[model samples]
Target chain A: MTLEITGLKVSLGGRDILRGVDLHLEKGRVHGLAGESGSGKTMTGLAVLGLLPHGARATGRIDLGGRDLLTLPPRELNKVRGGQVAMVFQDPATSLHPMLSVGRQLTEHMRHHLGLGRAEARARAVELLGKVRIPGAEEAYGRFPHQFSGGMRQRIAIAIALACSPRVLIADEPTTALDVTVQAGVLRLLRGLCDELGLAVLLVTHDLGVMSAIADEVSVMKDGLVVETGPRGQVLREPAHAYTRSLLDALPGEPGGPAEPGGKA
Target chain B: MSNTASGKTPLPGRGPEQARARRRGAHPLARFLVRRLLTAVLLAWGITLVTFVLTNLVPGDPVAANLGQRALGDPAIVAQWRAEHGLDKPLWEQYALHLQGLLQGDFGTSQQSHRPVAQDLAEFVPATLELAGAAILVSLVLGVGFGVLAALRRDRLSDHLLRVLSLVGISVPTFWLALVAFYVFFYRLQITPGSGRVDPALGGAPPVTGLQTIDALLAGRWDIFASAAGHLITPTLVLALYTIGLLTRFTRSAVLEVLGQDYVRAARAKGLPGRVILFRYVLRSALVPIITVAGLAFGSLLSGTVLVEAIFAWPGIGQYAYKSATTLDLPAVMGVGLVVGVVYLVINLIVDVLYGVIDPRVRLQ
Candidate 1:
């Protein structure tokens, strides 16, 4: 397993935001954690990378390749962050630095993580931009995020996430703020890139359509606990927990067909 | 949609740039500047006119004051003096003559001191400038330090400490602070000189520039200047403490506001270190308001140190103006009034120009 989270608990300002939760994932796979708002899905994701804000307390073993992430000090975490793990946020418009050229944002990550020099990083940034299918990638490097369309901004963000070839990519509702057409395009692009790069994606979202389409496994969480977990095929086809059953029934998505090979089971 | 706004346009007076600015709803900083400068000039003139009227309305006979004490009881001497000084003329005639004299560099002699108004200013204005300059520099150092520290330690203990410190600074009376500072540093400790820019025992090169500190610095006499600063420091500190408090609070609030913006939160989420997030995202956005407070405070500092200079026995324009009022030296009082008014207006103009550069929304009226 590339990343394994076990029995995570989180509290903020005297309130329990995340109750005990456990989840596991391996390399070259996408696991979709589905939940409604305030279901503790995002909190669990933040715990894996230790991104919870000031005064928030978390306890659990988040072992990414045998090293407990929560236990590592901040200095050690810096060496792993954007190197072993990277993240893509929901609102690309907010996620991007408006004042900086996208090229600098990419090259900075490349130089920091991959130890690439100035020329090497620039070449890699252009290649990453091309891989994300941003046309005129070289010229686009000079432009700011605001100059680009919302879809393009998300693409640039995806490119930044991929620059380090991280072991784990935690995408927190990467397409939530985007339009439907753009959402589909971004989803497809992420899935294709994950397969091509052999990267593991922890897709944090509530949409089952997205989960079933790209994720090999699905973990349905409620109130910060993973209520049901299985291969996508078995989970979608058979009823196990009542909450999962109701969630699947009430789901707005067209009932998903059989999960692909190596899917949830 | 209209190109080159024509006479038929509703706002016919607006030029093409103004029309475009209105369409975009961008900062009409150029227009704003034009309006502000006009207001500043009118404000200066209003202050000058009021000072002129107030001084003339005083019942004491300035012409009698001009005459020596021996001539005070003699009506013939007062009448002769009034006739000679042009007090017999109409108010308009007096104002026009004074304005003409002001325009032509003929400021008339000080009645009490019998010095040319220009000569009195040349000797006195430099002293005020020095005091104000030192006070402003001290405030800038203290205010910016507290502001940056407060922002860094925002919502923390240090932030609270600095805020309380600034409030205390603002609340204390300047005259009391000046007196206490004098007692501690001069009367008790004897660490610094009591008054004036320098000691008479070691006077430096003659005043080629009229400013003792400048002349001393020019002569490579650091010792004299240093001693002068030691004396000036106490009073400057007294006057600047309040300004520092105001600026620190303003800067802290400005930084806090910018730090709350979504872009700042976004920068943090990107995993960029806190230092980068602060300097790049937070500081840049806080600059506009910080610049504003600093500029206005600078003008206030220039004229606001009157009581401090007076208590410290510093020879400056404030002391000169006060003495002129008591002695009823009309020319001297009017001279200080006109100069201070001009200084305030010029400083405001500079601020407006700076505002335009900072945001490009201000324009000259």
Candidate 2:
């Protein structure tokens, strides 16, 4: 395991958001965290980064390569963030700074973590842009976020998350805001990056179809707790928990039917 | 899924919107600016109409006010005075004549000063602009600074203190504040110079921009600048107090809102240092609203300086307008009205231009 969580609990304003949650993500694999909204899947990802909203409290162990992130000093945690465990969020439109150019956003953390000079950071930013399959990488450097389409903006966001060459990536509903045609491209890119970078990825989404596409291991969460965990095939094919089975039943078309293109199973 | 096979096709990032947005980038700013300018010109003409109509509608008798009772008793003198000021003509003809003169850069003659209204404005406007400019600068610096601090330390001692201070700032009456500031700072403390733009002893700077401080600097007269600056300190503070409070409240809320945005979270998630996140992510994003508020604050400061100017003896358009209205100097009143109207329109235009500069999205639309 590149990252491990044991007995993670989170609460905010006297309300429990996550209750004794545990997850393990291995390097070179995609761990899909499937849940409905407010099920604490998003909260779980935030907790790992120590980026919970103000007034929220968390107690648990987040072990990243034997270093406990929960106990790490803020200064140390700052280095670990973007440097070792970067994140890509839902709604790329809001995730990227509107005023800043794509290249600047990509290079800002690179310079911060790697101590790269201006030229070095620029080169790396362009290269990362290319890696994300963004066309006209050189010319795209100076364009603002509003100039890009939704899918293109998400690609830029993914490029930024990969800027610092982090060991683990927590992608929260990375393709939720994207169109159906665009979703497959992003998912394929995430899957490829996981293998190419040998990085542990925690993919948080509500779409089971997305899990089927790229996730190797699947964890189903409901109401702040994981209800079941297994390989992608087993969780989708034979869910042990009643809630997980109900979620599958909620999908369109008949259960055990062959999945249709551009349609959910 | 069957769609997965088609989804394998390469998807270009660029879309119609992107192409359109890119094409728009070339000349939209120039077009936007030109459109705004044309609108401002039309509004300015509209202002002239309103001012002309409103002054004529008022029950004041400019002829009696200027001629006095003894002169009004003589029928010949009254007729000549009326004819001289163009009051003898029909209202429409008088408006047509005024518009024609305005196009020729004439602001008519001031019944009080007996000089051209434009000349009177030229002499007095600079003082008000100087005071308002200084006050706005001071307010922006302190307001935005304290506002960001308040937001960062929200619900803490500093935040509470600033909130209360801002509340007092907003609630306090301007005239009363001006009076108190004058008495306390000038009479009791004697630290700041009393009313007016410069000490009578220094005889002021050679009028270039008409702003004493800048004119003095242009002439390289440090002594004059210092004296002018000293005189400016009290009134600027008095005038800025309300705006500082207004801006502080506005900026705090704006910054707080930006802090809640997803980009701020993304900045932190990228492991940016606390300072970087605050300055680059939080404050930069917060600037759009702050700029908006600041521009309005500046407009109000320029027009709203009457009470402060009265107490400080600063020669600005507000005081000119007050005297003009009191004496029923119709031409002077209209001129001041035009100036005020143009000031607002110009400030609004500036604010729009600034929005385009700060947020590219503004320029495109």
Candidate 3:
């Protein structure tokens, strides 16, 4: 089973934001889309999830478990979202509904998508929280998002994404808002969840260091196009494109000398 | 991080202990409630003092206003009346006496009615409340509905139409609206009853609640209730229009702002049904400002009722206050001002409590 995107194109307000883009993410692996800001990395993930903003249009084929997501009607697409293909957003601080308890927010999607009873959903929610290493999962269920630290909140967010045991997960800049010390914990959690659940993950980030640590396969994107696609080791060591080399060189303490500062990578 | 990673508990430190100690101290909601209640009490006293001072400042002779032409003809009678009412005392003494009387629940006797101000309020305040309550009900129902509609259809023709309609509703003078309502509904259409609380045909049912429509219902007098309700329609509609306009505008903007938040988009991404997303996420967040505006609007509606009460000749405190103001009945004016201030503070306190309930972050803070 795999989540594949072919020739994805997204235009917002009649302006092309993402030109033709292709990505392949498989079960039991994390595929990282590494790019600079405004390089359309997040848009690619949004396109796969059919979450383009109002007035934005996408022409693409998003294949998930042999079903073409782009062709599915809204009703059918909704069944896929939060059920078979869920997403972890960039900012945990704002991604959660401020008014809802973490437990209610966690259980809502499972109840709606999986038809789980309230009791069953509650039990599963606590289990999911535990899976994310939340302390006192039962007590945490009654607490709102504001009560949690940023790292813990992000862990809860990941638990929400994994509520229905979706085949594919899209984590868009999942650790960008977190402190450097806390970032490793969240990255580790995502990696462990992938390995244990055998879930395919599309890990989008601008940080090459994050991609190097977590991603098995990496796609280097520049200006809405994937410049290089290979195993993380090969691409980092033996760069194929000038943009890819600059991206690697941009990393702190990376060899091959720094390119012209402020130049577009 | 390593402590957590190693699956061992961290060493005891001041940070966590301090946080726990803080949490164990006075709960945030309790603290907030205590602070708000103290403020409300202080504010009520301040309002009473200000109203008393302002009434004293106005250029008018309370003795003349009370005694009418008799004060001009007989100086001895005027002096006796002023002394009896304690108006002969110094301003500071008058204020202290007034404050003492207020503490004892005595608002003083009205110059016009010669009845205790408190008694007049009891007879009139209910009528104003009934009218204002009905108006608020109408405003909430229509305002929230139209606001949600406009927000959902933002920037569309329907949205533009609603915006223009609310603009006109807000700009239209309430007194003028009451007049126009009388002209059209009472004069031309002849659909609504023109004036008074109830028709004389009903034999004026015994006052229980002091609200005619309600009292009529309780007495099972359908004809009286119908007549009372009909009389209420024009004034209620006029009063409701302004609130509806304000609420609709506020609700629309608030909902629009909430709909644009990142959390709303996150809700959509969770595959929540559009209806669920709209109500649970967008509307819930939008309700904070709406509740605030609704509370403030209700306070203003109480004041607005004076003009409406005058036009309809509805026996409410607003009408009493208006007549008292014209006759320079300082005690009655002060009583009305004090009541309005108290109502405003109470409503604001309720709104603050509601904010804490609706949003836990507020309570926790």
Candidate 4:
């Protein structure tokens, strides 16, 4: 086990956003978190990193390896973030600072967490950009966020997330803002990188089709509670809960048409 | 749909094409500056024209207003006075002569002061510039500071107090505020210095930069500098009150907006220090709007100090304008109008240039 979240409860402004949630992500595997909007899917991701909104109260254990993340001091938590755990947000456009260059954004945290010098960080950032398949990695480094397309910006965001080579990655709807064709390429890159690095990934999204495509294990959530969790094939093909069944049925084409594996998984 | 936008991605070997495209237009900033200069020239010309026409159109004779009824009764003196000022020429010829003198950097003679309008403005402009400059500096520092504090403590007691103070600053009339400040600080409390630029005993500095504080500094006159700075406090605070209010409200909203951006959250998730996130990510983005509002506030402060200047008895351009307008000093009125117009144009140009520097999107566009 790489990350274990047990009985996590979060409340914001006197309202329960996440009642009680449990999730476990294993090394070298992708755990897909499936839910509709306002169903605590994104809240769980924020909770794990202690990046929840202001005035939010959370009570639970978020264990990474042996340390309970919820109990760590801010100084220790800062080391864990971008070093032990990293995150890629939903919309790449606004996630990256508009005023900063792509290379600056990619290398800043690398220098902060890994103690890499300027030259070392630059070389690693360029390699990461190339690894993410950006067409001209060296030239793209100095360019601003607006200079790149949505798909390319998302790829740069991923490169920044993978900069310090953390053990766990949380990607919240990474492909929701891209075109269908571009989405396939980004999803493939995400899966390939996590597998190559043997990192635990918590992929959060509302789309079941994305869950079918890359997720190794699937967890279905509704109204701040996880309804079902199992292997990808069992959950996507068999969906024990009514909410999960309705979610699977709402997909386009056949009931489980797009989710049906074509010789993989 | 962003389909067309997505198609604009740069591929391999496109660097040279991009460079060539840039070369065709020159540097964006250089081009932008050139455009702004041209606009300023055209606007300055328009201001001179309107000032000349409007001053002439005021239904009063400068000859009668200046030389009085006894001089107007004498045809010879009236004709000589009119001819001396080029009022006897055709309107078109008068305008042509005015433009010709302006091109030669002559602002003509002022009937009220019996001196050249250029010389009169030179003496008066420095005082107003010094006063407004100090006011804007004070307002900007206090306003941005208060604005950020208020935003950080949203809905708290300090925020409410600041909000109320700004509202009072904005709504209170300048003339009344200036009077009350002068009365309380100078008359009642005796803490601040009385009106005018400096004490009569100091006898002013050598007319170097026209700004008394700097001239005093340049001359190494610490006594003169202290006196000049002491005299500046009441009037500067009165003039800065409105602007401080304006900037506080604007900056509060601007900072609040930037604090909510997704990039701020992303910056936090990167494990950056709190100070780093606040300055680099939050305040940097907030600065664009703050700069814009501050520029506008500074412009208004420069031109809008007439009431404060009057109440404080400061020998600035506002007093000159009031005297010139009441006495029908056409040349002087036109000169004041031109200076005010040019100040606004120059400030707007600076703000536009700053926009390109702050946001790269502005530069590329």
Best by TM-score: 4
| Collision pairs in model 2 | A260-B1, A260-B2, A261-B1, A261-B2, A261-B3, A262-B3
If scored against the real structure, what TM-score would every candidate get? 0.73, 0.92, 0.92, 0.94
* lDDT for predicted candidate 2 compared with the true structure: 0.88
Q: Candidates ranked by DockQ, best first?
A: 2, 4, 3, 1
How well is each residue in A1-265 modelled by candidate 3, as lDDT tens digits? Answer: 4988998888888788888899999999999899899999999988887888788888878898888998999999988888888899989989998988899899998899988999999999999988998877887897889877777888899999999999999999998878766777888899999999999999998887788888899998888888889998888778889998888877766565322211222
Chain A TM-score of candidate 3 vs. true chain A: 0.95
- Give the per-residue lDDT digits (tens) of candidate 3, residues B161-270: 99998998899999999988988989999988978888877776678988888998899989888888988888999999999999999999999999888888777778
Candidates' C-alpha lDDT: 0.77, 0.88, 0.86, 0.88
In order of the candidates, what TM-score does chain B achieve? 0.82, 0.91, 0.88, 0.93
| Candidate 4: tens digits of C-alpha lDDT, residues B251-335 | 8899899989988888778887788888888888999999999998988787668988998999999999999999999999999
Q: Could you give the fnat of all candidates in order? A: 0.05, 0.54, 0.41, 0.44
Which is the leading candidate under DockQ?
Answer: 2
Candidate 1 C-alpha lDDT tens digits along B102-142: 77887778887888988899888888887887777778778
Flag clash pairs in model 4: none
Error of 1 at B336 (Å): 5.0
Worst 10 residues of 1 chain B by lDDT: B1-10
- When summed lDDT is taken over every stretch of 10 residues in candidate 2 chain B, the lowest stretch is B1-10
Q: Write candidate 2's Cα lDDT for B1-365 as tens digits.
A: 11222334233433564567568775667877888889988999999999999999999788878887899899999999888888999999999999999999899999888999989999888888889889999999999998988998999999999999999988888899989988998899998888888989889888889999999999999999999999998888878888999989998999899989999999999999999988888887899999989988887787669888988888888888899999999999999898888888888888888888777677766
Residue A110 of model 3 has an lDDT of 89
Provide the DockQ value for model 1: 0.09
Residue B249, candidate 4: C-alpha displacement in angstroms: 1.7
